[model samples]
Target: MNDKPPFPGDDPFVDSPLVDSHCHLDFPDFQGDLPGLIERARRAGVTRMVTICTRLRQEPAIRAIAEAHEGVFYAAGTHPMQAAEEPMASVDQLVALSAHPKFVGIGETGLDYHYSADSAALQKESLAIHIEAARRTRLPLIIHSRDADADMADILIREHAAGAFGCVMHCYSSGAELARTALDLGFYLSMSGIAAFPRSAEIRAIFAAAPPDRVLVETDAPFLAPPPHRGKRNEPAFVAHTARVGAEVLGMSPRDFAALTSANFDRLFTKAARTAPSRSGRQE
Candidate 1:
């Protein structure tokens, strides 16, 4: 459990603070060394992270993680992939969860037609429910779109037209059109380790075309570990690696990109930005 990954000394962004905007800290992958994982992340300049609950039933565990950690926050929703199997989540249930001080966002929810195409209708229904919750909570909707970009964009556009709400397309690797639609709607696009892949030129170009103020960085950890650690399990600490690649893709200094993305995170995940007194009663 003590075999922590070494911090990369030669990494240019080693001193810059970063945020892992999306991850699943409760997953069994890091259960053996959660504390060590957090420490490694901090040492790598990842100062904050948001652990997302993909199923509504797991909200309590996710909430507990945020409650127990100083710089961690949580979001809950029924993942579109599980939409057909999991109990349908009501807007009220999600809004109730937002009452928790650390419940900072609405979802890792959206259409995932890639593997769950059979549940398309149910996924859309679930997505709409989560969107409403985001609107009511004023928390950003964390979307997980894949393969079905047209449907995703259409639903997002229609729902947004009905009422406005903040959102971020997490782990965005969709086409240029959806990226444009999301940006035009004043939503954000989060860069994940996938964008760091050597063959991800198209993905990088999509991000490069996006407004910097609306860009975010995440690990989607326990998955998508960028190069050097690719194929290994991912953790929040690895977000810094992805950030460095993002800087390279955007032609900015790593430090500048880190700062920009962190600022963008604060802007979108506003609840996490407010200074609050920690358990020791000192402002954090």
Candidate 2:
């Protein structure tokens, strides 16, 4: 007569329903074990997850994955690094994809000059297209910026002035000025596992300075796994470790921090929040 939860680990935070605001569950790493992996996320208190599709052609597979999982939602767009190779995504194509109940956001798109500076122009063009899709669909754009703070801030400010759209700077590790600009635009800043790295003091300060209500949490799993699990393969369940670090950075208890970020996620990704069910085991 053991009636506890089916998952193994205990969530240190109480009544703190967590959401892995960004992940890539459709990637090959989770291929044959999606169900078990999702259950692990649930056991760790990650009740919802948003899997991102980096290329439009992969949208069908990503969409099918979202359709198959109750707790999963998805976003699709041309990632910056691939902007040069992939066909420039049209706003119409993105808007059409938004028709699905499980499609909750417009992008994992934006500028990335770090390794793909040669395609900066293409990335900006693609980013603008995604912004338009977000504006039309009224879904938040999940942005991925890197080593292009000045241009990123300038472009975001310019586009926002042209027409307002919600956004969350996914896996944010950019400069403080960019962070300030994003917050000023009424957008969200997501804290990822990168924030938990021991050498991320400057990044930690950037997040610490952000308003609690404007912050969100993500794993960007299979990429940045946070400490203890750092340098290893990351998964949605590991988001709790990042949350624990985020809670410390914000000087709040894990429960309070988890609650705060979850509310922020809802505020930005309203579609996901609105569609999510009330209980754990129920389908959305």
Candidate 3:
């Protein structure tokens, strides 16, 4: 199943040390060209990817992708919307399935109010289960809070107070207050390439004031593609734009930005650790 190429490359920007903290490499959009897609990502400076789990039904497909790629990693949990289909992916199931070495994080799970309101309630319940699994497994939770900030906050605060766990609010589209609550509970905020868009002033503002150690960059790829590639399917390589944009927001060079956020990713998602070569694979 291994298809990774260790050969050195010809591209300049492809050698930087950057990581795309989240992406859906298992999705059908990527299924046709897993090897080439991963190669392109590597050539674009993306060395690692946490392929997300959206439904319990898709775990096998996602696992297969991770098994085939050398540096690819994955998570196991039904996303909020999947609660309907997998009404029983209990905290125990999440904790149990997470024993696999490649199962590094606990979710792409959290509230997403873009659909049904009933789904929102189901989403919140699912989030609690993932949080509990995260607490038990001590893996960082990959949160996906959307328009339900009030509910999302209430749940995080309540569960965190009950028993603490590592968490990262992925793609953070919420406001300052929600960000404050997540930070107050020791959660890292993962910024996607969306922050690079001109319309992301509020998201950038949150990044401007976030604690350095608590800020991580992501692509959420095959979705959220950065500028220059906006409206297209995103890939791990696009994480470079996130680091670049994040650097601008934090007032640092992209290299320093890459190093900083890579360190932050390691800090928060510890068990999913990495060791890059001295030569960073990402360049401007």
Candidate 4:
């Protein structure tokens, strides 16, 4: 059976330049299709994307993907679910990794009590280390939070209080209180394919309530593929679908919303923005 969902329609924001703020291009799902996947993303007006590395051991491979692709960047950290299984990452080690030009963010790290509640303490410890890395490297913290909103909020609030660090709640589907807390801390909330589901009105409402300037769009590909491609494997190209939904939620045109989120991404991921080449093959 063909699992690929039909494209919604002709592209509406053909001229809009977008960025996939979070994804995992190194995953085996895209093993032999990187070039085609990237071309589709370009055709969808996705000019840049950050491929995240959830485990430190995979950083080399992730870095290579970013290096091989002109518009791709990467971030590395121990994923919360893998906290107990992996060697604890040190702030110094993460800081060292940040020295790469394409290494732009600190983590896809945070709390994931849904599947790994037994490792909550380890996850928290890992999160604190990633937070410190983000602070030291002056890079945005890419957080993956699920079923641990309260602790996530508390830790983020406490960590920020000790010393400020930039962050983005990747695939944010948490409660309003956590959304407010993240926004109050000046962190960005990334809308993933989940936000585009027909049953995601509450998630859409949270985005609607957030400051447009503080919101971003991502695919989190090979995972949550939004409608029109809902049940198929996701890719960076599919981020535009989520962006379209985000545009509707925020009452902006597709092109405008794309530009808005791209700007927001640039603001938070300064390293990527600073070094990313303009479409003309010139430094931006």
Candidate 5:
């Protein structure tokens, strides 16, 4: 399962550190090598990373991963694709998990019609529950939508109208309409390595049109590695590549884009920003 490249490129943007707002270091692909993977991320200017827990039952292990690493934080929720299989999550359960100091975000949960259409209803129920937990805890909900733009937008809008909660559309590669809806809702749109693909002009344009402060970047790693490593396993270190493309799309330098996304991450994942020690190991 160790498909990570021998070396993730050199730290070209070391002076301009950024955060990988979404990644899953607790996944089997990173087992036993978490420390090395994190160090690689650090050397490549990824000052912090948020490891996500896609199953509530796995939260203990995922939380342990964050506790063992200095700059790593975690979020927990039942992924939409697993909605039909796992027990529906409750808002109270999620809020209680938020009591942990290292638990910084609410979910990587949302609808996923493309792969699990049969579970759509369950996914929506789970999504609503997560929304309520985020509202209660005042933590950003990390959303994952795929091929369900209209429904996704409707739920987000409906839920937000009920009560305000921060959010980020993690690894966003959906339609421009969904992008617009998310941005209009004061939610952030995160750019992943997919946006760096040569055939992703539309995706790049979607990001380009977004307000600079409303954009974020992620690797979704051990998954979407950006160019120079597109088909290979991804890692937090490679977020620099996606950030480079995001910068180009926004007509800004890589450094500025990194800073912008980091700020957006901090704004959305406020608990992480408040608790994570500054790179210099002191209060900011």
Candidate 6:
């Protein structure tokens, strides 16, 4: 009765459940063998995945993947880098498109000073659009912040002031204040494969200190693959490794980590959806 995004199906990880809240399963890397990859993930206990959007131009493809998979869901928005280059999806477009039966969130948007610190105007403009879309649709917005905590925090604060909305700081690697601010603003901080990196001791501490209910896990697959599989292309199945590390850091068992995080995902991303069954298969 406590599960979330409850869909029509049985879940395999009822006891040790985990959700890869962010990934790009629609990318070309999975095109040739999408079904097979998804099947593999199902056997590995990844029952739900949010195939995030990088550009508004790719929303259709992202939507197709979500529609084809029972447990797979999607978000709609243009990435910070693409917002200027590609045709940006207007707030109306995002709200309308994200209303699809399988779509449950908005964005993969936020500042990325790591890539383009020189263009502050462009990044801020891009982020505001997606934030407004999230507000309009009342969907959790997936954010990708990198090397720009102050601006990111400011924007989130500003947008949140206009109206209350939720968002995830996707693959968080920022300092404690940013995490704290995001938490204060009612945002979820998603941890990725980076947590287990030997060099990320400081970041790992920040992650450990985050409020568990406000934390989420992700593989960010096709990137950030975790330990024992760090060098390989990332996938949803490897979320287990990330979960294991998270459990170790938070002083909980992997199974407990699964249960708690799954509950957390439901609370954050699938608020409108029902709790999925305990026997649900991998949503690659």
Find the candidate with the highest lDDT and give its number: 4
Best by TM-score: 4
lDDT measured at residue 37 in model 3 versus the true structure, 0 to 100: 78
Worst 10 residues of 3 by lDDT: 275-284
For each candidate in turn, the TM-score is: 0.94, 0.95, 0.91, 0.96, 0.95, 0.91
Worst 10 residues of 1 by lDDT: 275-284
lDDT accuracy of residue 243 in candidate 3: 79
Provide backbone clash counts, one per model.
Answer: 0, 0, 9, 0, 0, 12
* Tens digits of per-residue lDDT for model 1, 55-80: 88988898888888778889999888
* Candidate 1, residue 75: how far the Cα is off, in Å: 0.4
State residue 11's C-alpha deviation in candidate 2, in Å: 4.4
List the global CA lDDT of all models: 0.89, 0.89, 0.80, 0.90, 0.88, 0.80
- Model 1 clash pairs are none
Clashes of 1: 0
Write one digit per residue (lDDT tens) for candidate 5, span 1-284: 97654343465665687898899998788878887787778777788889999999999999998888788899999999999988899999999999998899999899999999988889999999999999999999999999999999999999999999999999999999999989999999999999999999999999889999999999999898888897887889888878888889999988898888888888888888875455442334
- Model 4 spans > 4 angstroms off: 1-10, 276-284
Tens digit of per-residue lDDT, candidate 2, span 223-262? 9988777888789888888899999999999989988988
Q: Per the 3 Å backbone cut-off, how many clashing residue pairs does candidate 2 have?
A: 0
Give the C-alpha lDDT of model 5: 0.88
Off by over 4 Å in 5: 1-9, 276-284
Residue pairs whose backbone atoms clash in candidate 4? none
Candidate 4 local lDDT, 93-177, one digit each (tens) = 9999999989999998999999999999999999999999998989999999999989999998999999999999999998999
